[model samples]
Target: MSTTYFISDHHFGHKNIIDFENRPFSDVDEMTSNMIAKWNAVVRKEDKIFHLGDFSFLNKERTQEIVSQLNGYKILILGNHDRGRPRTWWLEAGFDEVSEYPLIYMNFFFLSHEPMYMNKQMPYLNVHGHIHGQKYEGRHYYNVSVEQLDYTPVSFEQIRDSVVVDEEQA
Candidate 1:
């Protein structure tokens, strides 16, 4: 069976992101290769991956080149930087699907590029990216930013099993 994975903020070809985020790579090439290996180490061809966004700062061809190396059927939700390009651009850049806004998955999880205002009073748990190193302090928030995830995609089941939100909130 195919697993569903989540990851974000690759920021490929964006050199300053290395310094800004304290990523452990010398250059964009190294970062891209390392990320590809890490992503494919767990994800497979049949798997699905939700990339919450900020995927790259490269040109479309370069972006497609990097995307081609990764495993899984990729889906992207637009992030702040990603807004510069149209959905068609991301699709051409090799994502299988793209969403301009947040999506609800598995009925109760709110999937977004930016963390939304989620509380126990709300039924949905927010799974998001955008804030690379900083995190929201609550069981209601899950950050899948690459910085938090060792540059590898995490399984949806892993995210689901790790949280214990109140069902009464529904």
Candidate 2:
């Protein structure tokens, strides 16, 4: 079976992230290329990838180009940065789904951008990007790595197992 992968906050073509996140890339092109390479390394043609949001920077053309290079059946969870663009752009890019809220699977919740306040009462574990490294404290969240996420989508089973282990220890 094909693997499912999840990733977010690539911010391709955005040089500001270097200063903001202390990323090592010197320019936007370098950052975009590196992110593509990292994604291609683990992604296969048959994989399914969910991009949480902030997929690109500045222009839609650049975003389209970068998204085209990645291999997968892509699904987009729209982020705040994706505003102003028509839905057609994402639809044409091969994204199976596009929404502002989280997508739920099994007992987990998938969000492209971070929630202002995670719903701690929910049984679902939240997987999201945007904050980079802020801990979730009592709630469950996954901070996916861009360098390693590639095209492979994270599995619900893997997330459940990790949460189970963490909860057991707590």
Candidate 3:
């Protein structure tokens, strides 16, 4: 069975990101390798992944190479850093879909590269990335950045289950 996963801000091949983001990796290669490992560990070959963006800071060839190694059918929600590239560039890099704005998933979850407003009154929860390790105070917003999720792709089921658990506790 295919599962849906969410992740963002791998920033592969971006050496400065290590220091800028205070990433745990000693170097870009280590960060890239380990992130690929973690992704493959949970994402099956047939699984689908919504990559919330800022995916890489490399030439087209290198970026495509990195995307090819991962185990999932990838979709991209463009982030600020992803702005300069053409849509074709991302598609050529193996993304099944690319959206310039937020997408509503399953009619109950809002998916975006940047965190958007949400509350219990809203019809759907907001799932986003882009703030790195930061998190919003509201329970209706979920950040799936690699920094927030331990450099791994989080399954939608996991998010849904956690939300259910949180609701029960409240």
Candidate 4:
């Protein structure tokens, strides 16, 4: 079975991100290589991965090259930095799909590059990125920032299990 996964904020080709995020790479090349390896380690070619944005700092040609080396059907939800390019550009650069706004999935997960404002009365969970290592304070929110992950794409099953566990503890 091909699984669905989510991840964000790779910032490929951005050198300052190393010091900014305190990422463990000496430079951009090392960062890209390591992150790509981590991504492929858990995601298979047939799996679907929703990248919630800030994908890269590289130009289209370089981004396409990086995207082609990865495994899975990729979808990008444009983040702040990513919006500088037209949606069509991202598609041409190898993403299977690209969105300018948030997407609702499985009728419950609200996926976006930035967290949407929600309340306890709302009936959906917000899965988002852009905040890097920080996270919001609610069960209704899930941050998929690479800093919040094992530097690998997170499967839907994994998110579901985490929600279930948190609910049980609540």
**TM-scores for the candidates:** 0.95, 0.84, 0.96, 0.98
Name the Cα RMSD for model 1: 2.5
lDDT of 3 at 38: 96
lDDT for model 1, on a 0 to 1 scale? 0.92
Tens digit of per-residue lDDT, candidate 2, span 5-88: 778878777778778877778887787777788777777889877788777665666666777888887878777776556667
Q: Which digits, one per residue and each the tens of the lDDT, describe model 4 over residues 127-168?
A: 999999999997999999999996888999999899999889
- Candidate order by TM-score, decreasing, is 4, 3, 1, 2
**lDDT ranking of the models:** 4, 1, 3, 2
Error of 2 at 55 (Å): 0.8
Clashing pairs in 1: none
What does the lDDT read for residue 68 in candidate 1? 96
Better-scoring candidate (lDDT), 1 or 3: 1
Off by over 4 Å in 3: none
lDDT of 2 at 131: 68
- Superposed by TM-score, candidate 1 places the C-alpha of residue 137 at a distance from the truth, in angstroms, of 0.5
Which of 2 and 3 is the better model by TM-score? 3
Candidate 1 stretches with Cα past 4 Å from truth are 165-170
- Candidate 1 structure quality by residue, lDDT tens digits, 24-116: 999988998999899999999999999999999999999999999999999999999999999999999999999999999999889999999
**Clashing residue pairs in candidate 3 (N, C-alpha, C atoms within 3 angstroms):** none
